[model samples]
Target: MPSDARSTDGSDPLDLSGGERFGVWRAARARRRREREEVRRFTAVSRRRRITWIASVGGVLTLAVACIAAAYTPVMAVREIHVEGARLVSSDLIVRDLDGELGTPLPLVDRSAIKAALVKYPLIQSYSVESRPPSTLVVRIVERRPVGVITDGDAFDLVDVAGVVLTSSPRRPDGYPLITFEGGSGSSGFAAAAAVVRSLPTEVLATVDEVTASTVDDVTLTLADSGAVVAWGSSEDSAAKAVALQTLMAAYPPDAVARYDVSSPESVVVDPR
Candidate 1:
């Protein structure tokens, strides 16, 4: 027999047994198990990072809402009130006028309530209230002007150009005209009488003693310089009548015209006693 063909199990090169093969398989299986464990660990770490990111965003959103709420709350209340454009009016009183709304939210403050309160004071003709955030309140006022003095019982009241009673005074004003009217008449009649007096010529108006609005059908003027009476039937044709009276006074002496009737616009009736 040839030496190469002879059977020699003991001399076989690189021969592996069943136990060795099983050992190699076991080693590979161990490596795959370790790789799977590593992959699971990485996945767990990534999931924890995603959870942390979501929590951070939610925390930021909640903080922003809280900050906004704090800004508009009482922490940012109005600290000062600035009063402007008020003449012949006490700023303290005007501030007192807004006292009812003090400490109120500027955004929630009612303008109508402030206006109604201000209107209660006859001197405040018009007013404006402004607000600035994080602490400022501004106010402006316009006061009414006195046109004449009105007698209401023992006290005298100041009247505006529209004949609206403004305020009462202990003593009468020196330069303003005096007005007298019958109590119980409508305000329209008194308003008309005031309008007519304002429409009179300056020279004639300066000499007027008292303007009486006793009846709608008749209006009377008493002269201050001479204590003479001028009968004006009504407020109708008042401007024309005033002009006619002016011309008559210029042409003829006031003494000659005792009772001047300027009720008619085109003609004049004079009665001299």
Candidate 2:
């Protein structure tokens, strides 16, 4: 019988022989094995990538933690404090006040504490604090300058331009003129007097012994040794009045003049003895 002939029992006409069927089965099995091997390779590659990513993330987190820890340690602690822009107030006093912040970590230093410590000093008008990395803290201060002295009962109170009492003593300090106002430092008269005193030239200021103001418009200054009185009208045209007074004083010597009226400034009058 032909090898390709149909069976008489109605079996499949093209049915494979045993060897051919075995070969087909082997081919399918090989294909399935190859597919399984490819799946395993892909899974292994994916797992390796995941492990590397996790390791990289863990390394970064560990490095960040170490850096933060170092910042809070003695390695970044404040070792020195520097003070600047202090004139009347001693730098040593400011440094002593900041001693509490010493040895604290640079990143952990409390700025509010520093400010609180500094506020106790009335001389410090304004201040700034700077943190220099790894070891140093810097403090810069602006001090209030005393412009005049006020007589408080028997004691003399040194005051700044804003009328803040800087210091008080039983005896009056030299170089600062005595200032008196009708309503005290908070009055408009004192405000006007303070402004006039601040505007005077150094030469004129040196000769002033006392300043008095009853109202904002009526301000007067008395010369130190000469006792010459200056009638300065209001705070207006103060600079011009200062110049006029200087010229008038130069023209008529201090001993020769009793009074100077520079209220108008443009037209100055001098009363001579």
Candidate 3:
């Protein structure tokens, strides 16, 4: 051993040789390289996160601008109007009534205003509105059905089951019976008469000439050719009463029986004149 490498206390001491110095230098260099690699990884992750956030923000802004442009532009405005399911009311009238909604945007049409205009026609029972994109608006309506005719001096007023007068004509229309109520069409008596008339079978309905009701429970019907009368007490058990009347007519024939009382359908009464 060289004098310069001697132990201070004659014990085995650390030797600062050239080989040991090289090993220390290698350990320090490895530590610095690992720290640099960690920093590079962190920087890469942070840069990727910033890029993702920017892309998400840009996409949201583009969608918002496109929607605003579509809503305010005239490309989506109503240019045509179509009316459907209107029978008694003319399609021309519905289109004319909706004229104010023509230039408005399809998404901004006022449904309440459309309903207000249609309410002026008493025949429209129900209605719906639909928008056809790019330029069209469609309105569908269900009209009231007339069941009977009421005598109105010089003309006859056609009425539905709810007693709404649809139209008046100079003479009676075919397939409808004359309805006479002690009170006017608005009375409960007329409602009962309407129910009885509406419940009659097609064969029996065609045979009815006149219907009269003083009260809701005193409805009566007169046959056309045979002139046989039917006493329908009330609107209750109407289906049963119709069946019983049909059976009685079939068994006795219209000429043999003067009247049928099916008000209490369980105990039907027949009067032969």
For residues 156-212, write the lDDT of model 1, one tens digit per residue.
Answer: 888886666777878887766787776522375676567778778888888777787
lDDT of 2 by residue, 1-273 (tens): 557455778778568899999999999999999999999999999999999999999999999999899889998999999999988888998899889988999888999999998998888899998888878999999999888999999999999999998888999999999999988788898899999999899999999999999888999999999899999989999999999999999899888999999999988899998
Query: How close is each model in CA RMSD to the real structure?
Result: 14.4, 8.0, 6.5
Cα lDDT listed for each candidate: 0.76, 0.92, 0.90
Error of 3 at 41 (Å): 8.5
Off by over 4 Å in 2: 1-70
What is the number of backbone collisions in each predicted candidate, taken in the order shown? 0, 0, 1
Per-model TM-score versus the true fold: 0.53, 0.74, 0.71
Superposition-based RMSD of candidate 2 using all C-alpha atoms, in angstroms: 8.0
- Give candidate 2's TM-score: 0.74
Q: Which parts of model 1 have CA positions greater than 4 angstroms off?
A: 1-92, 95-113, 130-147, 160-164, 185-189, 201-203, 247-257, 269-273
Total clashes, candidate 1?
0
- Evaluate model 1: give its TM-score: 0.53
